[model samples]
Target: MAKESSHAVHAAGAHRVVVIVDENSNPFELGCATEIFGLRRPETGRDLYDFRLCSPEPRTLMRDGFFTLTGVAGLEAADAADTLIVPNRPDTDVPRRPAVLDAVRRAHARGARLVGFCSGAFTLAEAGVLDGRRATAHWQWADSFRARFPSVHLESDVLFVDDGDILTAAGSTAALDLGLHMVRRDYGAEIANSVSRRLVFAAHRDGGQRQFVERPMPDLPDESLAPVLAWAQERLDSPLTVSDLAARAAVSPATLHRRFRAQLGTTPLTWLTGERLALACRLIERGESRFEVVARRSGIGTAANLRTLMRRETGISPSAYKARFGPQTNG
Candidate 1:
């Protein structure tokens, strides 16, 4: 994990987040926790989380003396955090202290949401928090993870799997995606989008982390589809189709379908509709104040269709969503 600098703002909010670390900790994953939950987002006019690092013991070297961390809180801190994160471990079979696993189990038993980043799935599995839950980890560790934890429904193809209270991220940076999703779930889309913009990260991703998984190269030379995706995004208000995408990419429809499946893990139409719906959500939250206008602008076809889609996707009407997440004015 590259060390990215972050600036803090006014601290606010009551949600407490604690990250659990061990001797074999991965710095990048630790950094992910600190970067996402620890930072104070001034743009939102308040800090999001009361974030800290907790260890079974005090202070340890991370990643073979890459750096030493000090002044870390102990397992008692996990008792107070609303969210508990276990960062990536160096090895799948590394011996873990019983106290660390006990702290994790106790944290989950008391209703703290448990999150495993990258190889941290191992720690969670050992703690038995993921026994019957849908979870995921970095692709490189999938086989070992599956072999060790047969009770877990391993979603090796996704960037992260969110099964309510138990969330697992695939790799180091996929933590960003999961963290943004948490913010969205806790605060609202408006706040999540603001944090993503400040980080200069993708506000929305097309598909799973399967695209990052290594595989044998196909016989045909594959060109990047990012440009075509960007072009489609610019004109999302207009109708888009598989044939249209093929033409834009200068490739046959069959080739486009194959590319979409291999690169994005979803069909082109699904990806396009997801993008359109994402836009609809943002526009609605930005105080659009009219479903008809938002639908037309987001290319969802009709206001009735927008209402149906919003209800089906979010279990809330457009009006209800706006009521909850629409622009806020500070008195």
Candidate 2:
């Protein structure tokens, strides 16, 4: 069994993110990592992370032999990573290389934050790092993962799980969700929003969302949450409710709930709250020091409500948030 980690990651400098590529690794997930962590952000005018790709071998073949990736860093790169993404491949049954597992163990022993995407949970489990930690993997592999690693708490329904030092994404697309979430944790909500806009993806999706919906396909081409979401986003400062969102979508509240579940894998109220909270954070980031002002402007109702919600969501008070993200004033 792996030891529990209370100590933070033994990393320094510009937070480095390293992805370990193994044979038969899925390219989509690798792309998601690079897009979120490695891409140069001309919009932000600064590289957010020191992202690197490493492999146990010099030449690594991707999932289904789609392409060969060569000439990146070696597995030793994982040691220097503040956050290390363990190798994930489609072939869950095939055992991970001993060297790869050793690297994972070494990283974990040193308190490096470890991430597992899709079937990568299996790798982390095999390395004995996720023994008692909660994690999520592709729903299809939930039973297998649980059966193989009985001690690990596997939350199959969730899109991902962020158990402090260890994180895991449920499926291929969920990788992006988890990646954006990581950016939010590292850089804050504002930068995460910028990255999401660049990808043209939804800015925030709660990790508790279902991994897969039974009827994921839209019933009609025109049936979309975009218009209603847009309407609600513009009116976040208003006393907006789920019913209001339903009316804007021209659907019954029940139908709205179904659509929200089908499309976003979240409830109407949850989405509304998230949007409002995001607005509140942005207001604070832009130097809204008074909690009362931020609360009213962001439609969060009151300063006390803002404090409770902010603490619940971000684990910090409005003053603390302002101190971290707000404009620095020299005394």
- Using all chains and alpha carbons, the TM-scores for the candidates as numbered come to 0.84, 0.92
Per-residue lDDT of candidate 2, residues 1-117 (tens digit): 333343222245457899999999999899999999898887865567889999989999998989999999999999988889988987898999999999999998887889999
Question: Poorest 10 consecutive residues of model 2 by lDDT?
Answer: 1-10
| lDDT per residue as tens, model 1, 166-280 | 8788876688888887776666677888888887986755325452623234445545677899999999889888899999999998988778777666678878887888788
State the displacement of the C-alpha of residue 202, model 2, in Å, after optimal TM-score superposition: 1.1
RMSD, each candidate, Å? Answer: 5.7, 2.9
After superposing all C-alphas onto the true structure, candidate 1 shows an RMSD in angstroms of: 5.7
Candidate 2, position 193, lDDT: 95
Backbone clash count for every predicted candidate, in the order shown: 0, 0
